[model samples]
Target: MKKRSWFAVLSLALVVALVFTVAAGCSKPSKQPTIDKIKKRGVLKVGVKADVLGFGFMNPATKQYEGLEVDIAKRIAKDLLGDSKKVEFTAVTGKTRMGVLDNGEIDMVIATFTITEDRKKLVDFSPVYHVDGIQFLVKKDSGITGLKDTDKKTIGVAKGSDTQDRLAEQAAKLNIKPQFASFETYPEILAALQSGRVQVFATDGSVLKYYESQDKNTVILPDKYSSEEYGVATKKGNDDLRDFVAKVINNMVSSGDLAALKRTWGLGK
Candidate 1:
């Protein structure tokens, strides 16, 4: 009976030891930093605009994304994954960009997103990579040369952008009240303007230039409303990624690479 009991005790000890060995081997590693996660995945996911020509646009002919923002995302991917082509693009508008970043659909957003105090509450922003001003795109025949002539006129803007607020603030200074019509995308706003549904389409000057290029009938007003500082946005609490993005932007600015990129896309001015 003693011998049998000894054997049973030895077997139970071995079983517990084997279970512990397997558990240790199967335990997950500690949480990985965002950069490491990207490296492991072998691709960086970026949210960008598909319609803004100079910044982020999908070439209809090539059916591929290209623009200043797309290049920047590729550069980041190269830094993180050792291959610029290891980046995936997800077309995003002002309204959907933040949602995708928040839901983990993309690692970051380089979608001509303006940095603002209110937005800083939800997502961390890298340093300003580009600065543009609000402007109006009006039909050549509309006779609207500037904000002074926009009183009581309807201006179209993107639904989630700050362009409307900027216009309101500027118009208040001029004692004018222009009606606003918001749309999901810049193309829709331009369409509304073409249909005479809205007399003006207001957005960043760089973006307005693209629409003006597409339609010779449209002209961007010379009056600059407000300066918008564009930044790369990362999920809130992802300081590591944000800092790395900031470093890349700072390097670009210092090396004149950002300006060169702008010139490549016809946004030099």
Candidate 2:
């Protein structure tokens, strides 16, 4: 009886050891961060502009976001999430773009955000998808051909845009005092110009073209204000996500999709 009891005790110990060994070998560590989470969520949260005309804007008639930037976001969603319609548009402005990205409110920003060194410190930018220059829009009859002509006239600019700073620097060079009136968005600036509240509105040439298409009475002056490049903005440290986005943009650029979209939106030659 003693021998049998000892044999049973040894058998139980062997079983417990085997079970632990198997558990340890089979256990998996937690998953690392991946684009898979975004795919699983079934939505690509894209930050965009709601009133930037050709780049990103909402069509009230259809209640859908449409434009070059919107198309780019849709392509990214289709590539990463397998559905072009899986994008949720979050309207963003220059002042709020970085804050919204840092707060994780959106996965990426496809707004017409200019890539600058200061901005690069806060977010990662995909490859330059579009190259443009700042320009001015004035009444077709304003007789203002360039900033040089606006010696003492009022100029409308968005509060947080690079245009505001560029205009200031240009005014200093010209030794002119510009009546600087700030608005929250490009549309607001455009409204101010159309209403004769401001003599000029400064922004990217592509954006000016968009506004001109909507209202033929407006004209973009044949003057280059400042050079700028537009790119996709992702939170800093997301190297994987940033690379993925960059790859998509590069592919689009090579495959003629970018050019096609630009032409479709009346932004290309």
Candidate 3:
């Protein structure tokens, strides 16, 4: 009788212990330190571009950021935290993306960040989320075919953009020095070109797509270079976080989430 009662109490205690353990496991993600941190904080901080329309932009209508990068970040947030709304977005630019990521102002950057040898030195990159390339945006009938035709003509690119370096490299190959006009943002460069302040908007084709769609008079010069592999970025030596992000990206690609997003944004190859 007494022995049966003792066994019943012991069984109850063990069942309670098991329940708490399972609950703890549910509340906290196991393994990766970065994943654990994110779970503890209950939110993911992501850096994204605010000016580029298709890639990332703050929609004036909703007062919320929207676009491919934003969609990617939201999907990742949903996977990590079980809710897409568990994300906080910070606007980053060509000049500030790496700086803000390095400063820990954001846990990850999905801001059309092109993977490059130089950028690899500063931070780690997840598997490529999008494949883009650099191209020249010129006016219709402007007679600019490629970099060889620049001939010291003014080319506009965002300040701190790798486009400047790419243009210089092309200039070296062509034996011509091209003049460059720099703006602080991608939209500003487009504005400069539209207003005839610069003859060309030379940057990523993914970015120029917006203006090309809006204005029929503009044309992409039909020359593509610098095969840009856009990746999510994390701080240097953050291999754990990088790996986790890479897994999320892989899942997104596999589950057709990313492909659906590309269609939603009207992003084509």
> Against the true structure, whose lDDT is highest?
1
Candidates 1 and 2, the one with greater TM-score: 1
RMSD of 1: 13.0
Off-target runs (Cα >4 Å) in candidate 2 are 1-34, 213-217
lDDT of 3: 0.86
Q: List, residue by residue over 48-142, the lDDT tens digit for candidate 1.
A: 99998878999999999999999999998887778999999999999999888876789999998999999999899989988999998999999
lDDT of 2 by residue, 189-262 (tens): 87899899999988888777767776788888888878899999998767778999999999999999999999
Candidate RMSDs in order: 13.0, 15.7, 17.0
Model 2 TM-score on a 0 to 1 scale: 0.82
At residue 134, candidate 2 shows an lDDT of 88
lDDT of every model, 2 decimals: 0.91, 0.87, 0.86
Mark the 10 consecutive residues where model 2 has the least summed lDDT.
Answer: 25-34
Regions of model 3 farther than 4 Å from truth: 1-32, 214-216
TM-score of each: 0.87, 0.82, 0.83
Ranking by TM-score: 1, 3, 2
Error of 1 at 147 (Å): 1.2
TM-score of 1: 0.87
